[model samples]
Target: MKIIIGSLNPTKVGAVKKVFNQYKVEGLNVPSNVSNQPLTDQETMQGAINRAYNARIAGESEIGIGLEGGVIIENDRLFLCNWGALVYENEVILASGAKILLPSEFINELRNGTELSVLMEQYTNEKDIRSKEGAVGVFTNGRITRTEIFEHICELLFGQYEFKKRKEENN
Candidate 1:
């Protein structure tokens, strides 16, 4: 199986590779066609779906994977949200990963139009934070990494696909 990942970010690519180890995975840099900083769940999910569809079409692969990270405000608190999508043929499978409430410091910066990756870099004093541990890693103190988050999402997506396939076969 040939799988194309929408983003060249190491974490996103690594998650797809890890989840679908038997497949040939290619990471392509594709635009998500959404805002740099998605402020709602709907926008975040759309970004993932767009990337997955675009990558699959561009790579001419059997499957495409997209992972998007965004922030959402709930009850006057900001939370980090991540979404992933798997596109195959005309079907799309979606899943959401863990959500963590961001500290006021991060939220303040995010409200000022700073992207999460930028805020992470500033908070961790590290360059290219997205390629590394990412915001989840920083907040979780390495207990959970961005790759792990996306991996879980992929697992859920794959599970859903398998379940649907099996149901169809049974029917």
Candidate 2:
């Protein structure tokens, strides 16, 4: 099957490739049609959905996958969140990765319109940290990576897709 990933970021594309290893995967910089830095769960999911839909429409691929990472606030604390969406024909499968609570230092900066990605880069002194270890990696002391987060999301998405396809086949 042909799969189109709605991002050129190596981490995101690599995760999708790992999940759909048997298929032909193409990475493209499709528009998410949402905030550059989503600040809420709903917005982050919307970004993923938009990217998935746009990627599906951008080519003749059988599946389109989109992964988006952002920060969300719950109970006055900021947390790292990641969401993914898989689109197949008229069906869309969605899944999310585990959230890691961000430090209090990020709360004020985030509320002051500072993007998490920027903060992460500054905090780690590593450029393009989002495309590398990511905030999850730094917060977890490298226990979890951005690619791992997206990979897990892809696994969940693929599982749901397989079930849906089998259900349709049985029907």
Clashing pairs in 1: none
RMSD of each: 1.3, 1.0
Worst 10 residues of 2 by lDDT: 104-113
How displaced is residue 159 in candidate 1, in Å?
A: 1.1
Which 10-residue span in candidate 1 carries the lowest summed lDDT? Answer: 103-112
Over 4 Å off, model 2: none
lDDT of 1 at 126: 93
Q: For candidate 2, write residues 7-81 as lDDT tens digits.
A: 999999999999989889999899999888888999999999989988888966888999999889888888899
